[model samples]
Target: MSASSSVAAGRGAPRQASGALWQALPFLGIFAAALILPMVSNDYWTLIATRAAIYWVLVSALNLVVGFAGQLAIGWVAMLTLGAYTTSVLVAGNVMPPVPVFPALGVAALVGGVFGFIVGLPALRLRTFYFAMTTLGFATIVTQVALAWQGVTGGGIGIVGPVLPAPFDTIFGFYLFCLGLAAFCTWISANAAHSRFGRSLVAIRDAEVAAESSGISKPRLLGAVFLFAGAMAGIAGGLFATLQSYISPEAFTFDLSVLFFIAILIGGRGSILGPFIATIVLTWLPEFAAPLVAWSTFLYAALLLAIVLLVPGGIAALLDFRSRRRIEADRTIVPRPELLPEILGGRKASEAITLKDIVLSFGGVRAVDGLDLTIEPGAVHGLIGPNGSGKTTTLNVICGFYRPETGSVTVDGEPLPAAAPQTRAASGIARTFQTPKLIGEASVLQNVMVGGAIRGRGSFVESLLALPRHRQDEAMLRHDALLALRCVGLGALADVRADRLQHSELRFLEIARALMLRPRFLLLDEPAAGLSAEEIRSLGGLIRAISRQGTGVLLVEHHADLIFEICDQVTVLNLGRELAAGTPAEIRAHPEVVSAYLGS
Candidate 1:
């Protein structure tokens, strides 16, 4: 074989950074202050820092949805109420006034999470401004209920919560508790940002429909993130309420929700330290400048807006780029000695995917009717059809993006349920879109990393703990992702954001993303739709290499000549029906195929 190309070096290419601090010294100072509160300060300072830490978690928690998941939530204050009441009801044994601490904190986390789930239900049926309105409306109703139902919430004044348990009563004890919880929330949020679960959130944000096709359940994943965020926010609220010995609707407001949005936009959306940095500045600057506090708040707002408009990547992109680059550069990459016999990589001619008698209906229209097809292992099967002949519809049904009205989709001889798209993907199927769909808001590497979510030593726990094995596994995956990007001629642009890629490069990037799945079979829909002749030639070579390696590739292409040159077998479709299926030579000579091509 001609020298096999290895993109090991390309995978480690350096990335340009926005030059912001990756790790914040200021946050480190705050962290140290939190742990040593009683030793250095009196009761008042300790309480202030404690409350600040709690607010820090609030912003971080909200970021999961508004920042990372790309959903705007205006009812976040409701979480505070849910948390305070849940904790009060559980630990405050004095049923008369309800005033206990420890158990309440734990229960608050749980109850708040449950309530968040309930509140998030509307997210399933709503999106964009409608979802925002729903959340805002819910928050308004919840606040009204809290105020009107004074019997439980102590009326407009709110409830006077009890002190925590024995150890927690002391300033040091309470300070340590607040700090630890804040740290825990930060660590978990950061890990989720890097883990498979986190990538799923980004995927959902980028494109919910595409995310489903890639095997991520939209509702379940969205609920999980919301629940997780709710729990964290509840902890913060519970702690803040306990520190002050009071809770009320007056304390939480819509302004707080807007502030979190501004903070994430300024500090960076995905970084753990972003919220900490933004919260500290927002919380302290006004306090220190009490004389002109309102004006100070206005200034902060202006600063946040300027950052969003100018340095859109936020502080995390500016600060962490070099650190991530240095880390990526220090790893070694080894090309597999032999490509494996899997869908995304490693294959030799074999039968892996087969489609028989597939039919797709969109209400009144028949997109695909009685489509019979078989894709063998190590074969490049080209699907050719005239306008509206249903090539994409066939791919959609097979991938579970659309369920066929009357047909079965089988992978390796097993039929998958229509609703289970992720199951279909997990069954070893991967695909690229005609229009590239990726999480553009995320880092270039993270966008592809979403597909490299196979489980191994790098468990979610390992990533959270930053363990040795997890780091190693993460390094390996990053290397492989870069290599895959280069395989499709996108090596130089590995670190460039997908949204910023040129037209031709976008096509390659889409294929690069699918390759991250390590699929057993792949479906390429119009991979050459917008490519020039030169790009198309290179793309043809790639299909051949993929076929030679034993990967079964089903390609849907509009360019008839390119299909003939690249595909080993060709299937022609007309009016949603398979007109002919044969080798390229046979297809070129068929009378019926000619008639379809030239008009019968």
Candidate 2:
């Protein structure tokens, strides 16, 4: 059988539903045990199990912020404390009608969201160690305030929490109540991880510049994740307080915050089930080691250190390792036959990009000197120069990565309003980097999916709920992305990890991703950098096909033959200044261009 047919047959042979069921069996078993444990186990074990459920809610939210969003917020415990204290104050003061425990939970979420927003404002500005330090500072500040505030918080003494009416007041009822709530929170997180928002977050975590170039707003998305995580922490806190029937400053500490971080790291950062499993293990480990009480804390620390040192991807990585290899071995790439359209049929034609008297400098060095260039629609405009001739720098200036100190960049006749990567991308411009910036851990399909982040319309809530609009957008996105991949000869490799691609394949993958934008103008930097002679020939054909589609192409290439073959016009630069510009034949025949650039 052909390789493509074998791959298609192998994938089509599997019962998708049965595979999903097998994957979910562990979670189902856990839920079943949670339901029956209270009846079969002793009271102490039941209490431990109940507390584990609450921890699961908090840790799951943390996973989104830390794992996928790539924010190290160790101060999440402060939000939890705020929620518990808010519930305590309301119940003790009899401020509202006693309508069970749900109202208190709602109030806690509001309070948590507000505080989270407040903290995220300053915290999001910093990254890595600095961000962690800022959050750690907040944790310390909040703890001190809780201890010092004698009037409302009852000071170091503490306050009592309201009972959950009658039925829920009992241990069995409360255990069941927490289980249901934990499941709901887990469901929300699982949905977010698979949605467009989740993909954007992962992209931001992996490559901020690439993510922004694809039109994702990093700060805005991170703020929203911080807000959601804060709300979840608050809800978990309220439940904890109600279960214990008391709240004290001692319960919420910096140590507890670290524990939450440790749980997710040990379980796995990005996976949905990792935090749940980690919480159960960390919560009950101490109880199980009660006989060795003196060494319990030491044992916990040692185990965590071992996990960090041994399995950096967490326990989830180990479980997925064997399955991953097996899948890769069995997978076959099926090439798609449909090529990019010869003409951009119905799509609006791109206007010319004119750079007038462009001059860009870095200190004493002028990377791009006063130069005028124009790129017309439906043509390959090649930019050629020696090593330091500023070819790539000129592209950067045009694409908004660099702003020329003395030049006006215009589309058609109007000047661009801003020089932000996202803004340019939104204005019908897309680009590929010299290094081929694909997210290594992401599947080829997912890396391409990031191309349509803004184009895919749906709110975070709508996505979580799987609303009609969200589903429709997702389906359309998948189909379009697959088509783009096929056009670049990568349709069959969509399920493969991007890191596994060969050097030449990575170049094509980058082009495929850019094509998903349906860009009016495409910027290609060193698109022919690492390709073999045969690949370069194929690339020439692809560029021609794209240009015929009425989309403008700004190609920066070192291969003179390739440039002259496909490019209608060529501009040559020397020492950061343009030396010659004309039709390919005219520029190639110029005496100075031949002597200084083409070769002696």
Candidate 3:
């Protein structure tokens, strides 16, 4: 069997298993050490270890936000503080009847989730430093409220923490309880990290436009993550209050927030094990050097700077020894067009994607003017024009990236909502960018899997818990992603980071990602821009093969020869309007096409 066939046959299963084992080793070692710590260390050490576990319960979930989603949520300590106060006040019976500790913690989680969603609302409209500032502001407000609410919070005097009943009341028992909870948090977060939702988060971070085209709703996904993270943080706060036996505004400081945020950065983004290790190390650092505790924030800042300058990928990069191995110097993309049928799976859409009298403008310039086009299933349609001729613009219109002033995009004669790019994937439209937008830090296979974000049947909760439906979603996506990779000739490099691939390889990678959608209409935007002549020929062949499998291909390219060789019908655009439309032979001889586009 061929290499691709071997891959499809699950010959790589052992390697995958081995890789998974390696990934699990560090986490296993850490948790095992925590499990056995009481036997090896004193009660003082137990307290410190317990503190680390409590902090991890929060950081693990926050890793999904700051690390995976790339949202700068620096004020997550606000959730922790809120959780602590709510748990303490409810149990103290200051305002209401006394509540049990576990029940109070549960209520704290619910409250945290609501506030977390509120804090994260600005993120939907804001970005980067702006969102970070909002979180910090919220943290400050929480502190002020805790200080001013003297009756329930006890103001500066603070409130008594809840005491657990029976076995969990002892320090050792409590340590074990926190450790177990931390491990559970780690397991769930890791499950999410490996699921479609996890890959979608990374896609949103690095390739948002592509993510949108693939049907990842940033608002929905981010909102869900914030709620989960906040709940976890709230749980951590309850545990932390019990550990200290007191709850106060002073305990949840900005320094604590810095420690949580820095732990993720120092460990790495998109890695559970790295941040887990970082959390333990940072928790123990202050105890190791007592004098450094006063300058904890400064230490975190300095460490983050060093990590940024020296190892940008953080501990995760250091641990990824596989990436250090050199890929072959002379590599070629030998796509298996025959495998198209298997990947496409005979799921053919009978209707075409049609745009009628589309008029889109930017300021005073009409980017696309009175444009009408149709991409029929089982065919290749070419859109060709010179610079600024609105070829890409027209593709964007169909994809819902841009709302046309006067036009309608229809799939099977049903009008699609305007400016809703996230809806395109469900409508059976998938596209590639002119410049490949990909998660550089992610594996090629994972990047391709991002295209199938909408295809997963599992919900976020299912993914987080590793439920049956989530596992099935993952298995199906993984098998199809590998198939798509093999189809595009990137199967061998499936484990490699996407940024490591060559420019030509990235183009094919994008196509492979697009194929994951099983799109009825696959739109290519200047796909042949930076490819070699040979690679372009291979691309043209692949495009034709995809069309033959019942996928309507709308190829916007500058390579005239490629268009003539493969496209069934060619549409030539000049100044946002169709200048000529015919078969390759007819367009090749037309006087207007010859003068305007082909040559004088």
Clash count, one per candidate = 15, 0, 0
Segments of candidate 2 deviating more than 4 angstroms: 1-23, 94-100, 291-301, 321-323, 326-338, 342-345
Question: Which is the winner by lDDT between candidate 2 and candidate 3?
Answer: 3
For model 2, what is the alpha-carbon lDDT of residue 324? 71
Number of the top candidate by lDDT?
Answer: 3
Q: Write the per-residue lDDT of candidate 1 for residues 1-600, one digit (tens) a residue.
A: 112322433333332112223343555676776676667777777777777777877777777777777777767777876787667655555355544466677778887788788888888888888988887787788788878977777768788765777687887777777778777777667766766667777788776655665677678767877787787777777876777687787876776666666777677766667656777676666667778855754776778778878877777667655434432322221223133222244333334676778888777878888988888877899999787888888887888768777877776678877766777667767888877887765656767766766533565456656688776666666766666765776665556656665677667766766777766677998988887787888788777777677678999998888888878899998888988889989988889988876354
Q: Write the per-residue lDDT of candidate 2 for residues 1-600, one digit (tens) a residue.
A: 335534643564465346557767778888888898988888778788889998888887778888887788877898889888877777666455543467878888888877877777775578888888887888778778878987777778887876676677888888888899888887778778877788889888886667777888877887888888888888888888887777888888665787788788788766777777888988887776778756655665787789889987787777665227533334322323235662134688768999999999999999989999998889999999889899988888877778789988888687875467667777777889888888887788888888878888788878767788777667656666767788887877877878777888888888888887888888899899988887888888888888888889999999999999999999999989999999999988999999999985
C-alpha lDDT (0 to 100) for residue 68 of candidate 3: 97
Candidates in descending lDDT order? 3, 2, 1
Model 1: worst 10 consecutive residues (lDDT sum): 328-337
User: How much does each candidate deviate from the true structure in C-alpha RMSD?
Assistant: 5.3, 3.8, 1.8
Which sections of candidate 1 miss by over 4 Å? 1-47, 96-100, 148-151, 165-173, 288-352, 454-476, 598-600
Clashing pairs in 2: none
State TM-scores per candidate: 0.84, 0.92, 0.97
Which candidate number would show the highest TM-score if scored against the true structure?
A: 3
